[model samples]
Target chain A: MDADKHFIVGVFDDEEVLLKGIGKIRGNGVKIHDVYSPFPVHGIDDALSIKRSRLPIAAFMFGMTGTALALLMQIWMLGYDWPMIIGGKNHASLPPFIPVTFELTVLLAALGMVGTFFIASDMKPYKWPRQFDLRSTEDKHVMAIDLAINSGKTKDELRSLLRDSGASEVNEKSFE
Target chain B: MQVASSLREALITGGKTVKDVSHDISRHVENKPTKLWWAAMAISVAVMAYGFYCLCYLLWEGVGVWGLNKTVGWAWDITNFVWWVGIGHAGTLISAILLLFRQRWRMSINRAAEAMTIFAVICAATFPFAHMGRLWLGFYWVFPLPNTWGSLWANFNSPLLWDVFAISTYFTVSLVFWYMGLIPDFAVIRDRAVVQGAKIRAQVYNALSFGWQGGAKTWMRYESVALILAGLSTPLVLSVHTIVSMDFATSVIPGWHTTIFPPYFVAGAIFSGFAMVLTLLLITRKVFKLEDYITIYHIELMNIIIIITGSIVGIAYITELFIAWYSGVEYEGYAFYNRVSGPFAWSYWSMMTCNVISPQLFWVKKIRTSLVATFVLSIVVNIGMWFERFVIIVTSLHRDYIPSSWTMFSPTMYDIGEYLFTFGFFFTAFLLFAKFFPVINMAEVKSIVKVASLEKKENASH
Candidate 1:
């Protein structure tokens, strides 16, 4: 298991350096496990061939749910439950309902997007975390590639590739 | 000097140490006496004291101290309420709206704007609370509160009740959003404090920071929370101003009754909010010597928003005129005509020139970038916006359906005092904000600076 877990991680001080390192790692035919940085590095997802985020789909579903809920709430309140004539206008009027509908739509979409983001990212409070490097949160950019140790030549090849591609540091790690 | 060189070299060599950040921020904090801060604080305190005095008088004498009468029941008090609420909009817009847009320039100005929002809301809240003859029983406005005499249920049909709910929600949400953003930055300061007393205070701050270690997981959650809050706030902000507009539109007042009020009010709120943000940023940037962080690019971006929102408001004005004429109701038609050529025509023209004409200058990059021009324009936009509310309330009320009720209204000395006192309420809160909290989102700004460096490297490689 340990032997199969060998990974080569290349660290850079900037996005350009990270991008160059990514190109070299891909050139050497290594599968990238992840690229971690302080903030989102645009285009890195494409470089690593990661799938597109599913947040928007979730937002749409939630928004539809919100619309349904808003309509149901208004209908129940105005149509059946203790209907009062406001401004001598119809109780089930759509114009008056627009403001509440709009508010609920946004509220649900926002909450849904956040929930999906949390679930997909596997983030929760007070959990023990895997620290790649502390300085990644401060200023450094790191790109990590997972490779099979049994492949024999992968480690040296990755080291050379990263060094040649202007990686500030290259290190190897094994995960259980 | 040697330390500075080494720091510069380290940054260039891709070893940009945390020490550099600590040194730069701390040196600024410790070295300066903040003369402008003292001056501003002194003036704000005086204004606040006067406002408190006015409030006391108003509380003692009753709501009659103001210029409000039978026809114009809502005058300067409600006008100021809407104005302050409108001014509060930009803060959330800067922090939440810009965050969602992935705009980096938002970092420089967001802290001040957020602070401004909170302060402005405090001022806005005062008018409504005091406007109630029995200010102590203000909680009665909220429904579901039981009373001994009777359970006075808030009219769910009334937009005023909606205003109460909307404003309260906006205030609570903004406070939470602003405080959440401040936490990590406060931790940064906590980690660097050298003084013993400062260390104790830092510990308190660190605790309040919810033990943020800036770990990957923490960043993910923080970002998620911020994004969610921003998303929530976008519509929430719009709803707030819309509800405020409804306070007028739901009424039978010919000039105030229009479907256009919601969007018109929201656009005007954003326009005025951005203008106020610009006004605050101009002074803060100069006084704090934050020229590099709050670059010309940030000013230009704010100007662009000002221009866009200003144009939206201008269109609303034209639409209102067109609708008034098109509707063909005599009272409505006369209301629009009176606004253009009535006794309060000067106020209406001021609103048009200040809100519509002044912001048009932003279309020219030269004027947008010029600090002097931006500052003057910001003040003008604020003044014009105040008059917009004034014209809506005063003009429509002064000449209502009953011509017998037609009476010219002007603010008395007490009304003027109350107005001036709101400045006091605003500045007092603002002074405390500047003293206690970081006026800039230091963590966010650090991240932007890092990205800028990375971008520079990317460009260099190309």
Candidate 2:
């Protein structure tokens, strides 16, 4: 809860400027917090040293939940609850379960993933966002650098690094 | 050096400002429809009206208006239901499954296909509801309702009940997926609106958007929600058709009672659905002049899927035949033989040629890229897939058990009327979609432009 944290933002016209700026910023031994662009910039993750997303793991877990729920639901309904012979087939057959199981697996996985996504991303219905620059959605590219540590020379160094790396506009803001 | 120079060249040449992309898409939206669009819309509307009239007739009278009998109870109604449902699958597959795979080509056509999925599912749902004879009691299909006819419970083992659950689930999931994709594009339209009415529409859109600021948090949440939905939908989409397949596979009929039906049905669903997508995209891309966004690369990718799924269906056909022979069940064996060589041999051959042989042409790049060839092939695939269902349901049921009960079924005017009306329902929804929301996912397309920009950036560094 550092109330006096400062953020340095570098705006770029396109991805090339952003990439070049990233290189220079990282080259200056400044720890890059995050880079925001209108769309995904390839190689930005590697350049910014960001780790691979854990969303897939979440999806896998969701899929597993779906699979388990589907199997158990079928087992309970067909095996234990009022089991009746269908088409003279065995009561405990797995083939009939395959279709619903597959469907449920997909259903559970999808619903679980969506739920996790909303929770992780903090998106909810009708929530108004704070501090938005509309052009970012349109076309403008932006790179934000949080200045949590280091002031004075380090601040100047980061700003000059962004400028030298072809940032069209550099702005600094104090966060509450 | 050559790569570097080429990269630099591409960067310079391909650097499209935000204004350019907006201008390109807006140009299409702004321009009034040409003569052809008017002609097409007029024809579609006429057909749609006729369909509505027929539907009204069906609704007023009973489903007895159609050619369905005790033996062929599931005739045109079920066939059209399954057909449209199968057609609905490709849109979700293209949008959700392809999104997971990070296929950039999906950006151009996903919106249209998703729209088609909603419309087609709407079309598909009408039949079962209407055909229920007691269309007013459609709510009884869902659980937790006390049956008016004593203490009878909905049979859990019944595939029909499974179908109710499946179709309703599929419809809900697909609607959410379609609407979620629309939010950003709606925001764009909202921002760009100038006219008073348009501005009001924009305000409504903004309200619907829930004040999306498109911040990192918003994007992150949107992306995650979309991904989750897509992941959920992928199986949901697959299950819908699989459940539809179960309606056949779960039965005791000779040709229908096979374990392979689910996969086969799913494959056929994708095949027909892609065909429908191709058909719509072909017309849309040309009419809307979305050639740049829905590039030949996208078309080629769809073709590849069409080919693969078509082949999977072909293999399923062979497998069905093989399993029938292998099972040594005389009725099943005869069903297979009768399908291939009986009085309905023409239908079987048509299914084989249209579905199996036509898609094989995609193996050659020339055929896959050719619009005419692809369009014809898509039509063929649709016809073939429809026949596949028809052949499976009709041929098997026609001669079941006794030869004396054997009957040849023909579609009356009512059957054709119901069928045409479903098309009307589908086209009307699509027409409304085009008039309102963007035919392309603008945000997703913007993302692709970003990726292309990144590619150019990489080359510049080299």
Candidate 3:
């Protein structure tokens, strides 16, 4: 279980209303904890002010590793380990290495990116996710605002902000 | 007719809300097994059992049980391998390529296509296994692993080795792409299970979903990963079949040698792959009642690709003939001549008609748009592609360089049995997958619906 934290959760019936609610609430300087939607709402990340993911840099680094490893593995195995000339071609030919090199590059890139993603997202097999709203997956979008972030605001003030900003219902949420 | 054609054609028919999309797609997995599911499963199992018996008998009897001799070592087995592998190309084309192109229509169909790629690859894999008659040590011998034998290594020179690496890598990548895409949909189901008060269901789906919170940060990461994977797989789809083509082109076996094979094989692979997708989806769309999700637009667009690739394949076929004649090499000339007017002329003509001539009918708007016509043509195209492989493998090999060894080759019951084994394995695996997982890409589908919904909202506000 994660460290318990108090959250002001707003449930929304529609994505448009949710988007507008996010804008109004953010304009009022209330920090958002997280928004959960059944689907990826277009422009929601911009609305949430989330930084763009750095996954491509990770993918490129992994791909280079794979390329370097593939070349070394092939050269070492064929040229140094036990050189044998088949079909009158050189043992360490560049032409033949391209296919294997390409494959290893792709394999490492895909695996590394997924591994990085799982780690970055803090997805552990043992940890259960805090479910803010059961309807979040089915149809509704749920936005949770952390109360601890805005110490100046009381619970009532945040609740009213949620309601005025198009929250169908405002409820207190806690996560372990 | 023109007015009817001009009628607003949305990729998604039947106005469905975001919730409806989730409910409709997830119901297959969340609900009880329908009788159709049971019937299909029972039939698939029965066929699979028979196929399993065939494999066991094949192992017991050895490779000799199939029709193989000095002349034709690769006939039905490799043909089936190439065919199944080719059939799998459409899945990647639909998922990765379409995604890269920003085709919104791809959203609804990609899940099933990616699943098809996995299943088809699985089916393709059996041929290699069957080719390894000594199944126990076959893996150790063929697979490149450090052995106790001094200075032992697989031949990097061999295209076969390249194939081993390519197919395995393709399988791994496609699998990651497919499973990663499933995470969000699985989360959707998990949340639904929670609401239904099904504790066991919720717990199971949550574990499967990897604690997906559907946060904006997660979605951003999710979208980026999908794009990168699509980029990775696009080259993969092309490379795999190119390497497969090299298996023939690298050889000097008369008809086997050609510069045209890589692009030719790639086109043929996509051509056959789309046909297989259409064949399966036509039945699946009806059975699952997913007409709205898998609309006529999707079907027609796929058919247009078929026509284009089919034309490319047709040109390749002609080029092969022209080159064989122009080279003036006796073996190559005889190879092409023998195909058109040889012992296996029936198979050659079948290939031409099915692969080339029939698909041209798609130029007619009505023919391509008709579901029944599309279904029938899809099957026809598959048969044509199967014959195309047979023509390449068997026809080429049946007549050897040495006149004395030249002989006819045909599939024994074991060969048919081996093929049936893959069909059973593929369908059984797919049917179970359909029942257990979100058959539609719920998240992607919802994005499209979400956009449409937003547009509707703006109109109302104005």
Candidate 4:
């Protein structure tokens, strides 16, 4: 059997217990594969030591690109290509171009951030996800420890560790 | 669990657990549609069909069928467009602006509000779409597309063109923000289906959820995406109405050429938007038995917002009058005079009473908290807002500088039918959404209820 496909799953009843349990299990020198919950827990990111997402940076970059492209298109199309004066205002005037520019900037930033999120989170239509416990999408919090990742500990050892950490139930799951 | 402050009332009442939240919300989507839902839907569909027929007839007969004359070129079309667009604003205000402010009360209402936003915007788009008589042939002409006609491009300078970009961007962003929030909620329904052995339900929701796994990392990224999207949408919502107001403000017409139009229009939009939200939510909470989730406190808070925005709109009306007088431009002065005492004075007065005066009655606690009062006032505010747009468009355009060209604007059956068309479409789409989707944000509500449940336990021990 592939050890990497095997996981020691712990079902949690309360987020408070699950949070403290995360620190305790980590301190015991057992690495956790991941935690899953129906709703976002308040401090799970800090407990997991997950880095802050850099999505806003991506949004800003996409916004700047939108701004530049809108300006360039307006300037080229109106100033050089078509060259018709509207209300005798100067061709490629920046004042009137501001509204569309701001709109496109926001448009690209929003769409680009969502696209990045879909890609980074591996979410898409027709992609079946690896659900460790069905209850994680309902009322329970779930913690999974890969036996391969925690090679220092045996399956029985990790299962008991999960129980001691206040898990309501402990079980083993494997993927083909 | 997060600590709850004793100083504030619980946003959601009725002792509810996390499990209860999921069951209560998802049950609506999982079950077959109720008889009332089907009946409402049937009426909406019938109205929509009649409206669709009217639209087709108008399109075939052309713009002349809508009572447009030399003096009054724009009438019910632009009025309904602006009215629907204004109604659409409350959704983004709740989902994005209130989210940024850390208003936990918004959690219960935002999902339905955002859905209303999308439908209202769709309704709003029909006006401009129908206004372009040759829509099938020249709809793409509005976009900045490169074409064989000498590579001719849309004029970048016009406010009308700016409206094209602003509204499309607004609709697209609102849709994404709303759908992203729906993903986790869809996962909730999918999991319940799995437990109940409902295979088709599970399969459908799983596909709709994009097979969400609810992992720690994915939830973290989801939070980040929500925050940034909210940030993007706040400014976007503001810009949409501002550009729309500019469509009138940039023009040389005396009444429409005020510098205060942007802020004034934005305030009126929020005022009207909140009224529509209250109207819909009051019925929704009643029908769905969601009184605990959407508590009386939510109604009071929404009423307070209405009072504030309504007063702002009132001041804007007075300010426009003041500015029109102080500008000392005779034509501008006459525009205000014509609004008060002209042939269309009844519409102007109806607007004043409905938009400016009616909302002030909410300052009383009794009326503000009363559901019957709220429902009646909500419809009152929408009617008033519709007249607000009508007064702005028709009153300004009907009496031009040249008296010989001045004419009174009247609506043809097609015009009234077209407006009804939007109403039918709005209700039909909204009813379908209410049936098929989770009307409440189950995921967010569950998180908040954890704190509430914990708070209850702590109080019991004490």
Chain B TM-score of all predictions, in order? 0.92, 0.92, 0.96, 0.98
DockQ scores for all predicted structures: 0.11, 0.23, 0.61, 0.85
Categorize the docking of model 1: incorrect
TM-score of chain B of 4: 0.98
In model 4, which residue pairs have backbone atoms overlapping below 3 Å? none
- Stretches off by above 4 angstroms in model 4 are A1-3, B458-462
| CA shift of B370, model 1, Å | 0.9
* Candidate ranking (DockQ, best to worst): 4, 3, 2, 1
Better of 2 and 4 by DockQ: 4
For residues A31-132, write the lDDT of model 4, one tens digit per residue: 888999999997999999999888889899999989998899889989999999889889878998888899999999999989999888888878777888
How many times do residue backbones clash in model 2? 1
How accurately is candidate 1 docked according to DockQ? 0.11
lDDT, residue A148, candidate 2: 68
Give the alpha carbon lDDT tens digit for every residue of B1-462 in model 4: 566697777887788988889888889888888999999999998988889999999889898889888889888999999999999999999999999999999999999999999999999999888888998755457788878888889988989999999999999999999999999999988888998999988889989999998888889999999999999999999999999999999999989988999999999999999999999999889999999899989999999999999999999999999888998999899999999999999998999999888999999999999999999999999999999999999999998888899899899989988988888999999998998899999888888997776666777798
Rank by lDDT, highest first.
Answer: 4, 3, 1, 2
Kept native contacts, as fractions per model, are 0.07, 0.23, 0.75, 0.86
Candidate 4, after superposition: displacement of residue B200 in Å? 1.8
For model 1, residues A43-74, the per-residue Cα lDDT tens digits are 56556665555566677788789878876776
Model 3: how far residue B90 lies from native, Å: 0.5
TM-score of each: 0.77, 0.81, 0.96, 0.98
